[model samples]
Target: MLSNKNIIVTGAASGIGAQTAKILKQQGANVIGLDRHPCTENVDQFIQVDLTDPQSIDDAVAQLENIDGLCNVAGLPPTMDRLMVMKVNLLAVKYLTENLVAKMNDGASIVNVASMAGIGWPQSVDAIKDTLENATFDNIESVCDKHDVEGPRSYFFSKEALLVWTMRERWTWRDRGIRMNCVSPGPVDTPILKDFIETLGERAEEDMKVMDRAGTAEDIAPVIAFLLSDASAWVRGINIPTDGGMSSHVMEQMHQFAK
Candidate 1:
């Protein structure tokens, strides 16, 4: 159903984003892959972008002129800068969505590729709320200078806010017939897998119990393809965990598992 429909996939150079761009193209979307690094796939088009800069986002996406769907797969993951994580993961999401929303079809989709680290957003909402509001491309260095977060928590908070942003934007864009949602994957075996496992240290073993196995970019990318396609019409403002029921297992042990 996506034939000739222009779509944008950020972080298309590697991991989930790269896989997602490939999947979308196979499904017939005019895939525009955006990233700081060049992607290997011969996709519909490619535009290098440094998402930390608002102008870069504008210019990279401008290369598309207009698009039907946006897959926000760009991010630094955990074990990276707290502020940059938030900026790339959440702020850039807002930045691109705001700019591209006008260019999208009325019934287009906005899929924010979030993470399992974002699951506890309800509780941490207030703690990181200030940082999210203050995030800006022009002020990247300053935000990183202040309100420093460590380990997976930074990545967690960034995705958490993104999930929240998805829900919020769903309502914000509802009048325009646009839908916003998130896909949170668990223990994906992509390059970032080591980063997450490293950040968790010994706790990684226990965390793995939440899911039967680690996911792959292919496993998660198809879900984004669905959301970006007409397949997921009713899905909006929801974080659909593609972690092989791991999220449920963890949720089941919510009060039982300490840390």
Candidate 2:
């Protein structure tokens, strides 16, 4: 479905990013992989990038041209430093996308890999709006402090802000036929799954007990691939929960719909 397209995938060194690159290549894309480390996936090109650095992102973006799709998949886990999490998970994404959007083809798709942790975005509207308006690479530390986006909360906050940003930019590039969306995955069995369990402790255990199994990168990659393809041309600015019904379960609990 992605034949002849040149797609860029951040975090393509491993996990969902690598899997997404593989899938996109299988579907005939010329994949350009980006990550801090060398990509293990056999993409057409690989660019080592430090998502935390604006200069690094700018240099990487300069090398990109005629891109058809971009998957913002590189992210730091909550166990990392709070400020760094906010930088990679949110700030860098905004910077990268804003800079690269101009180089993308008219019908390009941009898919952000958000998390189920971000589902609480509706509850943080004021903070989201505030961050969207004022947060920049220069003042991210102060922004995090003002919003109490520290510790593990940084991960949730980053994802929440990302979802809001995705929706807000739904039509920002409609004139050029470019669209953006997100994929929110539940706990997936990646190398970082242990980090999530460790951070959330019992809450993570309870969530795991209620679910039949954790998802895999394989499970999440196809949905991302779909969003990157022409098949989803009309589906803009939506977050597809690739989370094995965990999102539905959470909504049921939130609304008291489960008997």
Candidate 3:
């Protein structure tokens, strides 16, 4: 369904981004792979990007000035300092989306790779709202410097901001006929796994026990491909969880505990 489309897959050098890029290409989408690390497979062209800097992101988007879609699959685990994670995941995203909005075809789609960790957004919406409202070009470094949100909070907050921003973006771009959505995966076995496991410690492993089985990058890529194609034309600004039943299971446990 994506044949002839121009798509950018950030963090495409490894893990989920790499897999998604490969799948998108297999279905005939023209793909641009962007990452800090160089990738060895599944890309038509590679563009090295440092998503933290506005100038860098602007330059990168300008490079893909003719692209049709974007898969914002780039992110860092909790191990990085809060500012770094937020800068890479949220700030860079805001800058790129604003700049790239003009480049996209009216029907083009944006697929952001959030995580199950971010579904806590409802309770934290107020905080996220503040974060987004304050997202200025020069203030990202200061905010990260101030919050010191390193570790899990940085990763968590970044995804939450992404989820909310994309939803609002849906409304902002409704008149233009553009679409946006997010994919949330749980306990995926990727190169990032070691970082998550080490940073999250025992709790991360415990969280995995609920699913009993981990998902593969292959499992999540197709759903992303679906959201990016004409098949999902009517879909807009929804966060789709592809974590088997893990997210639902978490809800169940929360409900039980509330009792």
Question: How does each model score on lDDT?
Answer: 0.81, 0.94, 0.85
| Colliding residue pairs in candidate 3 | 82-149, 82-150
lDDT value for model 2: 0.94
What is the C-alpha lDDT profile of model 3 across 14-114, one tens digit per residue? 88998999999999998989898887577888888888777777777777777678899998888887677888888887777778889988888899999
Model 3, 12: alpha-carbon shift in Å? 0.9
TM-score of each: 0.91, 0.99, 0.93
Best by TM-score: 2
What would the per-residue lDDT of candidate 2 be over residues 1-259, giving only the tens digit for each residue? 9999999999999999999999999999999999999875659999999999999999999889999999999998999999899999999999999999899999999999999999999999999999999998889899988988879999999999999999999999999999999999999999899999999999999999888999999999999999999999988999999898999999999999898
For all the candidates, what are their Cα RMSDs to the real structure? 2.5, 0.7, 2.0
lDDT of 1 by residue, 1-259 (tens): 6788788888888899988888888888888888889875936788888887789888865766656899989889677866677678878888988988878878888898888878888887665576567767777556545655554566887787788777766777778678988999888898888888788877787878655788899899988988987888778898899998877777877867645
In Å, residue 129's CA in model 3 sits off its true spot by: 0.7
Model 2 lDDT-worst window of ten: 38-47
Pick the winner on TM-score between candidates 1 and 2: 2
Q: How does residue 258 of candidate 1 score in lDDT? A: 43
Error of 3 at 5 (Å): 0.8
